[model samples]
Target: MTGHLHPLHEALERLDEAWGDADDAGQLSRRQLIAVTEALGLLHRRSGAMLAEVAACVAHESRTELGAASLAKEQGFRNAAQLIATTTGATAGDASRLVKVGEATAPRRNLLGEATPPKYPAAQQALAAGRLSAPAVAAIIALLDRVRLTLGATETAEAERLLVERAQGLSLDDVRRLVTRAEAWLDPDGVAPREQEQRDRTSLSIFERDGRIHLDGDFDAARGAPIVAAVNGYVSALFAAQKEQIDPEAPDAARRSVAALRAEALSVLCAHALGCEDEAPALAGASVVVRIDVSDLADGTGYATIDGSDLPISVSTARRLAAGGGVIPCVLGTDREILDYGRERRFFTRAQRLALAERDGGCAMCGLPPSMTRAHHIRWWKRDAGPTDLENGVLLCESCHHRIHDNDWEIRIEGTGRQSRVWFIPPPHVDPDRTPRLGGRARYDVVA
Candidate 1:
């Protein structure tokens, strides 16, 4: 119809040419496989850009102004998104996102028929260049559109440019992070009000489902940060312990899924909270850790980040958490050292548990957090006349503790203090050679 084929048709042709046959993928070299993946991804993005524009046009034609003769009404669909979804076999949500992005980036004409730039020119350019996905563009546009009213025109344009630039070559999740921070920067005055909105919406529901109790809940950033941190920390600890399981098929192996572990962690946390209600209760450990820049803390501006979350929270919320002892105000750094009491105490002190947390990063045998673990002797206090020294004590969760005792697995400490590492020696049945496997923090290292 034109000098060049439609972009969608060209993209489809290129995809077909580059992809060849799907069955041949298995025979291709790793390098060729990666190149093919990149090529396909680019073609998909090109088609996505064209699809968004087409969907937006369809939406415009189907606008309610057309009454009963609307395009969608004639096409036997309720609305444009439904029509697009039905035609493309995509989810309604995905189709709606495409329309939103297309409308935000499409060239505009005033009532007088004067041409004007799109709402987000940078995002439009990125989408047209196939450098951003529909979802990414929608996310960036949503954030900018939400905060633009509160920001100056220049600030709004600058934020749009920066977000579009940062979002390229990044995953959708990464784009969300950039958006989160940008929102705080672009509309600092709105953070407290939005936080209040979230707080107003916080709710929890519990009911019996089938044979088990089910919990459904929602929390705002300020109120939910600590709970999120604790639950995730406990889950990580359980995961670390499970990683060291010598026999997953064993009768009592730690083989719970992440969902199950999170449930267990929640139960343990509730129980611990109840225990703290009694007089002479045990000392409570920090459940949440909030991090903020010194300058922000002083100026009462910007945002703070809570552990286990990518969302940015208002400085006021961070200050509130800090006042409540939920945030670790100061870094311990290297000034803290492992405390040793050679058989002088039966239980590990809080100071000592903190030190062990630094070294083991949780349970020595598994990766459970220090709060849920006991400081057991590498050499038993009673059986082997083990000392209560830091070097001799090891952190073990209940499951791993019983596992070592029942299965004859051994824990060894190599080096001293923070430089030390934990190793688990498997029994003969598990490993005939009884080889020592690396445990503790090193187990969580990203191996290249």
Candidate 2:
């Protein structure tokens, strides 16, 4: 470093120094803790900028000078991505991305020895400034690269500039939203064609590897967005459920890793999809039997193992995963006596789903389209041991389902078939008197 350190670099250095001195920060109030989190996030971004800078150099030397493709082959690696992945311990997807980003953001030169501008100047600047992470850069590139020809160079550049600015303090998801909107704006006629093209590109694959299911796929926005919403909602619900089940006095047990939760959610989703088959195997039959040593189950303090895996989830998460569904909780006494065996009839049948969809008119709380809603047992089949029946079943969008669980809202079915209505009972905090709100088309008499 010959010149003075970049402003972001200097700030990061100072942040590290200050952070080291704040050893007792774990005890900060929630608000202060949030700030500390934000501070670390910014520092991480600063580090990302340096990472981009180094990646650019690596990309130039390895790919341009030594011919990355051939050199990597000579090194006995499958490709550049494998070389990077082996070195960094990143997934192939991540390693491949950095390699691409480095190549895209690297300097260029014409055959006549004239300087050629980088393809993504805004992204390059943002990366150098530590304003964008490698993943964000990849997202911007991926989105822009999709419809760039249709959008034209001017529109694409403008989108890149605006997106870089928007990505500064926003998440990669937010950045994607920004790019998506911009792409839509830049090409009005191209939107449908792009979506169609993307749909044509959709795919999904699931394979078992060492008792764990590995999922990989690409989906266009129309299909992809819902999956994102579902996974996010379920993941959020998992964490919220864990918090609720905590004793509020003891050490908070570690919840399942995000990866594990995502896998579990996908499993639940697969169960729903597969149930549509008339001869579909009973998903509940292959119940995830959780064996807990009774003391832990009651104390809500210890762990239980799901069958076929040694990874122990807290009793809290165990209960949540077992709710109205595929998991069977088996509690044993100190002498290993069978204390409790959770019932098997839980997950809603495909017939039940179709029946509820017709009855509920979409989410019981919000009127999202039926396709976006999940089958939620109003009486909570797990906790209440409610049966998977029409009177107890309703379609609830992912968000509303989570809200009902996390926000402590109540749901009930009032009236008989053909006149039955689903109602939500707001929490007392939401409505001091706990008003009963019903779902239906509101009619107002107007004299014409």
Tell me each candidate's TM-score: 0.68, 0.45
lDDT, candidates in the order shown = 0.73, 0.60
| lDDT for 383 (candidate 1) | 85
lDDT of 1 by residue, 348-430 (tens): 77667666765665566656555566677888788888888888877777789999989999888888766677889998876
* Candidate 2 Cα outliers beyond 4 Å, as residue runs: 1-9, 24-35, 64-76, 112-116, 198-448
Query: What clash count goes with each model?
Result: 4, 0
Q: Against the true structure, what is every candidate's RMSD?
A: 10.8, 18.2
Best by TM-score: 1
